[model samples]
Target: MASRSVLGDIRRDLEAYVGSKIRLRANKGRKKIVEREGVLEGTYPNIFTVRLSEADSVRRVSYSYADLLTETVELVVCTASGKETKFEAHSR
Candidate 1:
């Protein structure tokens, strides 16, 4: 299990990417994986929000730092130059 400090670090890292484009893959258990593209909305103490647009409908989604710390959520930041970089967790 990840420690509280790890979660804090995750939140700090994500806060830097606020307002950037990103792709995320989240494990929903039972072999289900949800993937989407969105703009990093904001990062809070416990969770971060993303602004997503699908089929002309816009919605927001939130995920906790614990999700990233545990690898339940995989985030890849997209750059304006069309580059993609996966989020790296803090080494144990």
Candidate 2:
């Protein structure tokens, strides 16, 4: 299972990937935005899915790899209601 800290790392990496102004959502309720590129890669079992884009100011970025069986990263954004919104980063 992927640890919660992994999400933090991904968030931190987003800032670097998209530059230094990328805003990532902190947990739920609070939407964090940054003007940066989001590059994410992972192994089997542990995938990431991006669910929400906070305020819609962020441009959706996509990429693909030839290693993992799953194409997209599964990022679940927790909402203020303590619910999760699941999203997948797949190649089209």
Candidate 3:
């Protein structure tokens, strides 16, 4: 229950970054790391989506907030003034 509360709070904070540019880094097992820059498209009760585009193709990836809580995903929001706000999983 506590973990859910923490995730809820984190989700609310992330909601403010919608439509903003953000850097997303995730682990794909076997020490592989994938990183991408995209706009925080939208946030739902259980998951959020990020829209990424390369060349002429665009894609949207959805990840659950629980993924953040488990350190599966890391997010960094880039601000207009060159400041970055990072969000990572925290030990509970």
Candidate 4:
């Protein structure tokens, strides 16, 4: 219903950030917060992935657009000119 449409809009907005550097902040419940800087690697119909490197290991995290709408995840995309754009989904 309406939530699906909201998710769709959020997804579309994020699609443009694919292959770009982004900062992610996620809430892991119980007052835990995880933050990372990575490149937005891919986008699917329902989710998107970010690739992060730590030490010698690389991690890929996938999050749904709905997570943004719920404020579970937040993204900040950095442009070539050093401009940053924050993306978060909110009810209209």
| Per-prediction TM-score | 0.91, 0.23, 0.88, 0.91
Per-residue C-alpha lDDT of model 2 across residues 41-73, encoded as one tens digit per residue: 322223332222446664444322221114222
Q: What is the lDDT of residue 67 in candidate 1?
A: 82
Model 4 residue runs over 4 Å out of place are none
lDDT of 1 by residue, 32-66 (tens): 99999999999988899999989989999998888
Model 3 gets an lDDT of: 0.88
Worst 10 residues of 3 by lDDT: 1-10
Per-residue lDDT tens digits for candidate 4, residues 1-92, read 34677777877888888899999999999999999999999988899999998889999999988788888899999999999999867766
- For every model shown, the clashing-pair count is 0, 20, 0, 0
What's the distance in Å from true for residue 41, model 1? 0.3
Each model's lDDT comes to 0.89, 0.33, 0.88, 0.88
Candidate 3 has a TM-score of: 0.88
Q: Give residue 46's error in model 1 in angstroms.
A: 0.4
Best by TM-score: 1
What is the Cα root-mean-square deviation between model 4 and the actual structure? 1.4
lDDT for model 2 comes to 0.33
User: Which 10-residue window of candidate 2 scores lowest in summed lDDT?
Assistant: 63-72
Worst 10 residues of 1 by lDDT: 1-10
Candidate 2 displacement at residue 39 in angstroms: 11
lDDT of predicted model 1: 0.89
Give RMSD (Å) of candidate 1 vs. truth.
Answer: 1.3
